[model samples]
Target chain A: GDQVKQSPSALSLQEGTNSALRCNFSIATTTVQWFLQNPRGSLMNLFYLVPGTKENGRLKSTFNSKESYSTLHIRDAQLEDSGTYFCAAEAPQGGRALIFGTGTTVSVSP
Target chain B: EAAVTQSPRNKVAVTGGKVTLSCNQTNNHNNMYWYRQDTGHGLRLIHYSYGAGSTEKGDIPDGYKASRPSQENFSLILELATPSQTSVYFCASGESQSQNTLYFGAGTRLSVL
Candidate 1:
């Protein structure tokens, strides 16, 4: 069984549009982090959240540990945003390794 | 921001050959991790270390081993490579074991023939 599950395995968005990606955790996690893996295969850290919402420019993320879910919203999508989005959670039993979701492949086109 | 670098961006190894992937982080973070990414599996942890001289097995550590000899370096070893071990490997470093942010390396693509 997967401790972390992501929805909408893949998505396509036109430039200037908005979309949301989600991750659901079955385990009791304390925190969550989001990452964007660019086409060049570099994983860039996006946001790290606890139990609230955070906004950074055109990207916003929310984490609800009580409900065991997290959401990443992209506003005004750009071609540069085309990449794979992954969410990882920190669980008590997961040790130093964060449990990761299957990831959402996002393709933004002009 | 932490800077994690992985060596040998691409590698091809014969079956039963030994392969070692290296990682170096300049941030001096206490936690470092090794993970493999596949098409459908996303990113799965193979090993992690809290600091120098401390290595721990991760979720998928069956055919792999790890060594952390110093605070800035970590290595993942495949003693006997197999086709199943073909994947993209990434190294990450963080300041804490929990509630921490991680910085990742560019990733190493390994193909076992």
Candidate 2:
């Protein structure tokens, strides 16, 4: 079973629009991290949350430990926002390794 | 920034051939992990190590092998590559569970033809 399930396997957004990506966890996760795999396939950490919200530039993320879910919101999306978004969770009871999602591919065009 | 780099960013090998992917991290991390990503499986853990000279099996470790010869380097080896083994492999390093923020490498794309 997947520990983290990402929603809307794929999405397309127009420039200047906004969209949100969600992840629902089945495992008892304590922390969640959102990452962006850019065009070159280089991954960049967007947010690391523990039952809270954090915003950076045009990106924001929230993690709910009780509900076992996390969300990444993209505001004022741009062409550079087109990439694959992944959510990974870390459980307190287990190893330090993260369980990653299948990923949500986003294409932001003009 | 914590720098993690993977060598041989792209590889092409024939079936039954041996291939090795290497990762290096500048951050003195206590844990290192190897994962493979496919269209269906997302990212499945193959192997991990707590520190130098230690390796542990992960969710999927049958077809792969991992070695952590030193604190800064970890390698994933495919002794007998198969077509099904073609995927993007990523390496991540973390300090510990409490401060377990992973620093990921650029990833290695392997194709077993």
Candidate 3:
């Protein structure tokens, strides 16, 4: 079984639409981090959370340790937003390293 | 902004040959990690370091060796490369083990024949 799983393996959105991606953890996670891998294959950090919500620009993320899940919301999607979104969780029992989800591939089209 | 740079953006090696992937960080972070990304497995931790003179094995450390001789550099070594080991490798640095945000390098694409 996977310790971390992400829903909607893939997604498509209109340029002006909004969409959300979810990550569910089967392990006891204490923190979560989100990253976006661009078409160029460079990964950029999006958010780092500790059981709360965070917003930056058009991106908002929430992590609920009790529920063992996290969500990433993208508002007014743009072509540039098309990429793969990955969420990683830190479980105390899994050492100090993060356990990563398979990831959600997002495509925003005009 | 923290910068993590990985050298030789790409690599090719023959079976039983040795390959080394290097990473350098300018943030002076205490924690650094090495991960390999495959199609279905996503990214799995291979090795990490708490700081200089310390190295720890992660979930998948079977065919990998890590070295952290200083605060600014960490390297992942493969004593005998295999085709199954062919994948994209990433290096990251963080302020702490689980508290701060992590910054990743562009990645190193390796192909073993």
Model number with the top DockQ: 1
Query: Each model's RMSD to truth, in Å?
Result: 1.3, 1.4, 1.3
DockQ for candidate 1: 0.72
TM-score of model 3's chain A, to 2 decimals? 0.94
Cα deviation at B14, candidate 2, in Å, is: 2.0
Reference contacts reproduced by model 1 = 0.75
The digit string of per-residue lDDT tens for model 2 on B1-113 reads 99999989999999999999999998999899998888866788899999999998888899899999999999999999999999999999988756578888999999999
Superposition error at B87 for model 1 (Å)? 0.5
**What DockQ values do the models have?**
0.72, 0.64, 0.70
The alpha-carbon deviation from the true structure for residue A92 of candidate 3, after best TM-score superposition, in angstroms, is 2.5
DockQ preference between candidates 2 and 3, better one:
3
| Backbone clash count for every predicted candidate, in the order shown | 0, 0, 0
lDDT of 2 by residue, A1-110 (tens): 37789998999999999999999999887788888889898888878788989999999898988888899999999999999999998744345778889999999989
Error of 1 at B104 (Å): 0.5
Cand. 2 Cα-lDDT: 0.89
Better model by TM-score: candidate 2 vs candidate 3? 3
lDDT scores in order: 0.91, 0.89, 0.91
Candidate 1 Cα outliers beyond 4 Å, as residue runs: B97-99
Please report, as a residue range, the 10-residue window in candidate 2 chain A with the lowest summed lDDT. A89-98
